[model samples]
Target: MSSIPSPTLSAPSPRVNEGMSQGTPACPSSCDHFDLDYTRQEDVRTVVETMMTAHQTYHNRMHAYFKKFPSKEAALLKPHPDTTKEQWKELCDLFTSEAFMKQSEQNKKNRSKLTVNHAAGSRSFQCTRACMKNQESSNINPVELYKKNYTNKDGIWTSEGAREIYRQCDLEGKTYTEIEVYSEILGKKSGYVRGLGRAVKPPPSSTLTTQSSDLQHQLAKARDEIEAMRVAREKDLQEFAKKQAEMEATLRDHREEQWVEQERIRLEQEERMKMEQEHMRVEHDERMQKEQEHMRKEQERLPVEISKKLEKKMSSVMEKKMNDMSKRLFSQFGGSKK
Candidate 1:
């Protein structure tokens, strides 16, 4: 048997990966290269986030906040209590209750009913209008074949024309008895509710009340505002009282600090005085010893008569030292001898 010719390769190497050709097509390798994979992964995460329990983070972190409903039955029928702080992590089953599901279902049902009654009704009406629009001919509706002879002038139909107009669109489909009954029902124009042209009558008090009631309402509103202002002022006064107490406390603290500062200064002055007194006492003892030695030196160097006179002066000097010696020095501190 003749062998079929082998297909020629496009290139020495394959253009596409053999692995890609062998397996099911994956999100492209370029997806990973261009970070599209990570982005798609995040998109998937976002979808999971919406589908999973709201407490997923808390579950993952082991920091769950527990919420409870008034009753299991009530929970099923209504929304659970507002989200709150939970001290401990709990089993996911605790939050999954039949009542919760029932309540969620009930809520969904109520919403569905509202949607059916209002939204669906509106949608149905819209669809019907669309169908009517599509079906409607561009031409104006022609007068009924029997009433073709009737004519309207200045775009206004006369009473005869009006009666004939309703006959074709309204009375045409009804039975004789129904038409006879409906014929008695007169059409009323504007400025009338029951075809009697009687709309509203003001009561004797209504007009009077209307005129004065506005002023009365204004006065009442003003009074209410005044009362509200009074209450607000009272509340402000209470708040101000707290602020005033705080201010007084701060002032008291400041005064205590001032007193402490003054006491510290007074003690410093006392300490300075004590140190000066101690210095003066030491100087006095040294001066007395020097004077006694000087008297002895004078007796050896001078005549006996001069030495005796010096001894009398020495007693006077001793008395002067007692009177003149004091704490502190300098010309500012006046002494009896100086």
Candidate 2:
């Protein structure tokens, strides 16, 4: 087999044929010396552009991915384009309502979180009447999806799951008015929003966002100081209560001592009176016996006839003799002879 002939290496003609400048290099031009990072710079620009595009894409759901609805009725009636379009839009709205309702419920749930089981977890949900009305997110049909997935008795949402729900939905770093705070606290079982602020911090296009953030931080610190003061006051109140209890105990002890002293004095007086009464009684008995002896002696000296004549019978006279007995001798001596 014969090898093919090699092509001839011929140089181009050196003569200038065109009307352009003669000194310029043909292939290797002035751009060759310019300091450039062509590939790396292009790669960086491409990466930044791609990230920004992705962020924008996620910002709003794409119409190409999610079909558009001309109107509310159209969204409801013609959700599936395969269906007929002859009927009145409002009346036709009843056709694919289930799909609308399912999507609506799913989107709301996607925005909000819920809990299951007997944990009785708090889920903060749309507590504001205005915000909830603004959302316009509910089932087209009267289907109980929230009730099914989560536990619900009436139309009202439970505080148990509303906490985390409110947390995700709450705006960052903004403080609510007292009324809004009360509604959020009392109405829903507080979850995430409870710990979070009410409104967005550093909102878009704010010129004074930095100042506002500083103010918010300062306000929070002030609130913490006030809370600390309240706690100190509470501690002081507790200490006062302890002191009051101690004082009451001291007063009780003093009162008990007073009662004991009074009782001792009373018992001493009673014993003295009892002794005097007993001595008086003994003296009275002795005096009565002496009188009886005197009477008996007189009767013995008179004789039986005279004694019988004095009071009818001798023994009866002796039995009932003395009258108007002496005064109490107990008072004469305070347990000592007068």
Candidate 3:
């Protein structure tokens, strides 16, 4: 099986912290419940983006880990080491379910049809705005912020559509906010805010009625939806925290295992080297003994070889002397007879 590519997860941006500080409910020691002011657009945007990013990050991580196993049944049978059996089973069911698979395939198709993609990565438009304000110490023009987030660093537009939208916004003048420009040019989308990502849902549509009762009913419905979103956001945050802790623990365990494996290899190499050295030493000793034995045999045979040569020389010298003495005696006897 092909290895699963792990998704890169980042810490919550500064905008998330800013949003939490401004809009998150603060519960006292004795109080269990607190209220969120959904009317504030900035706070609402912050919460929405945080929740959406966290949810997407979590879904991607789960899918990446699930891909490690050959099948959903196998994955459920052997849950991730970092997750509980119950959690793993639930994830397996969700990933393998027909409804989810259909949605996932549809999402892929939708992504493939896109002509333009922002270069901002995980940074939301709100975070981009915050950064602009901090760096320039001035309020960023909404159109300029949109351009910055959509275009590349060299100021090239990602797509002709994005560029045309910018041109339209420019011709319309500077009064329009980023969201207003998108809504005006692209037409208002029913479910989500036009410029913001899919996180922030728009207010429900209301009938053009003069009656006070109808207005009250619309307001009540809006409040219900807002409350529901707040509750869902809280739950998402809790799940994200739990998963983050598990990932960290898993990383630590992996590092420890890697270190242990490296140490084992080092020790094995040392043992092999010691054995090689011992073998070389034994060979050296055997070679020295062979040389020494050869020299001792040569030394013992040297005296016998020298004694044989001396005996042969002395016998030849004695025979020559006896021949010379006989010749002299014969010559003298012959002279006396004459």
Candidate 4:
């Protein structure tokens, strides 16, 4: 017999093979590469870049201030010179402050992005107005931005996010900065341009004075809220304890009432049974006494009846004997006469 030809499996097309080799399908243009609200940790490079920008802006403002007020005896001259140790410490505090940072964010939101070309004559006046506004804005207090931003689970500061990503990717033995660099290389979107550092520059003496007052006010408010919460918590605990005690007392009283009612019913039943038994005993005793009396009367009547029968029999016997004697005497007398 002849065998039929076997069918062969076909290979995949060249385009399919090319896609498989490339490891991933190409993205369509409609698909966005950058996610504005990405959940990943912000990159260190972005933080560094933002810091550099803030520093440059601060430098420019300082140059403009000196140029406008060339004399050393100017009113805007601060107690501590810029970039000094004391000034740097204050700068750090200013940047870390929550209220000031929040105000900066709000200002960013409110301000127009478009740059306007103003005349040279109006530049100095506008600059002065802006400086005064910054001073007024310093009236807002600072929050713990550093603690909030760096300490949480989603934080990348101090290389936490980098370390986590590295662990997930099976990488080991890298410093924090190196891990961040590797994370970027892995095609992860770690880069960000949000408000990374303290957005506001350190203010002069006039602004610092207002900022200090605002800080004190915020601290006081926080303390008051904490105290109020403590008092409310204590009150709630006391109320709970009071309610528990009342419930226990009510239960106890109800149990006692139930026991008392059961005891009363038991006593009543016992007394009723005792009275019935006593009544039955009295009735039985009376019946026995009546029967005994009837028996005694019957015994006395029986003896009297026996004595009467005996006397009648004796009298009959005497009468019959006397009649027989008389008859014999008569017969003898008659024979003598003959």
Instruction: Output the number of the lDDT-best candidate.
Output: 3
Index of the highest-TM-score prediction: 3
Of the two candidates 1 and 2, the one with more favorable TM-score, higher being better, is 2
Question: Tens digit of lDDT per residue, candidate 2, span 64-124?
Answer: 2234655654455443343334433432343236876587679778757634332122222
Q: How much lDDT does each candidate structure score?
A: 0.44, 0.45, 0.67, 0.47
Q: TM-score for each prediction?
A: 0.28, 0.31, 0.40, 0.27
What lDDT is reached at residue 183 by model 3?
47
- Candidate 2 segments exceeding 4 Å error: 1-205, 304-338
Stretches of model 3 off by over 4 angstroms after superposition: 1-35, 38-57, 67-82, 177-182, 185-338
Model 4, stretches more than 4 Å misplaced? 1-241, 306-338
lDDT of 3: 0.67
**Can you list the residue pairs that collide in candidate 4?**
97-142, 97-143, 98-142, 98-143, 99-141, 99-142, 99-143
Q: Which residue window of length 10 is worst by lDDT in model 3?
A: 26-35
What's the number of clashes in each of the models?
6, 13, 0, 7
| Top-down lDDT ranking | 3, 4, 2, 1
Task: Give the C-alpha lDDT of model 4.
Answer: 0.47
Please write out the lDDT profile of model 4 over residues 14-62, one tens digit for every residue: 4533443565333211111222222212323434554675686784564
